[model samples]
Target: MPSNVEIKAALRDMRYLTQRAKELSGTDGTVIRQQDTFFKVPAGRLKLRDFQDGTGQLIFYERPDTEGPKLSNYSITPTNDPQGLVKVLTDALGQVGQVKKERRLYMVGQTRVHVDSVEGLGDFMELEVVMEEHQSREEGVTIANQLMLELGVKEEDLIDGAYMDLLLKNQQNAHAP
Candidate 1:
């Protein structure tokens, strides 16, 4: 499985973050709109990510839902038939939840910086510092930490889980009261 040191945080302002990222990377970044349909799996989490460009990826990943940078092991398969896969997966595994976001993606070295506006949630940013096959976890963490500092991500804004987890929690809360 391919891995990365991942960190996610709630964003206070997208404009400030985007500017800071641009200053550091000097790239305008790629913008994408995505909708992820999650599935209930026995281990880890599975999602079929459909991009607005008519492409998609079937992603499965496992990681502890921790507040700081943590390791995530994942596998991804590109699929052209997103709608069909979504239906089949939903039918076989049962749907968990769906999350929609517009993302501004930037690359700094082997790291990917994602500035996202997630529907029904809020603004957020994620850092995925991809690791080489022989790379140590410490290397990925070090890179992620440095990028965090460069990007001005505060500790207080760090998040504990994925967007699906947070979205489901909010839904439960809404229905509870």
Candidate 2:
């Protein structure tokens, strides 16, 4: 498993690459909005992610939700492979409810910025700044900030809670309503 530091560095690099690609293609940096519904099965975790840009993909993540910040995820584009990977997981777990959210994704420097609002949850922002081979957190946070600005996100809009927490709270309100 890669340490958070290492993962952060790699993400920064990926951001840089993505930005360069956009420039080369003569396209302004783009944003992607998406909503993802996740289901957990006995075999693993399955997710159906829908991008507002008219694209969707299914992902299967097998990592145990152990206590920690480390999360491992792998995705398979259903458009390319369709039934192969998705069927293996869906056949095992059963369907979990659809999680809905709108996410704005942007690239800045060497990082990826994700500003999101989840239905029944609230507003949240995530910065995935990839580091270079020997970059530090300070460098990564700087890059993250750049991307945040590109997306017009404010630090105050950042929420520390997870989606499930917000969902449960919303559920309670619905019950009372």
The window of 10 residues in a row where model 2 has the poorest summed lDDT is: 1-10
Q: Put down candidate 2 lDDT per residue, 1-177, tens digits, no spaces.
A: 121211111122334444543553345545565566666666655677766445568766544343212233354655443334345555776555556766555554555544455676555555555556576556655655554455444444444334544576677788994
Positional deviation of residue 78's Cα in model 1 after best superposition, in angstroms = 0.6
Segments in model 2 whose C-alpha atoms lie over 4 Å from true places: 1-29, 42-45, 52-54, 60-91, 131-161, 172-177
Instruction: Quote each prediction's TM-score.
Output: 0.97, 0.51
lDDT at 53, model 2: 49
Model 1: runs farther than 4 Å from truth? none
- What's the true lDDT of residue 36 in model 1? 96
Angstrom error of the Cα, residue 51, model 2: value is 2.0
- C-alpha lDDT values of all predictions: 0.93, 0.50
Question: Model 2 compared with the native: what TM-score?
Answer: 0.51
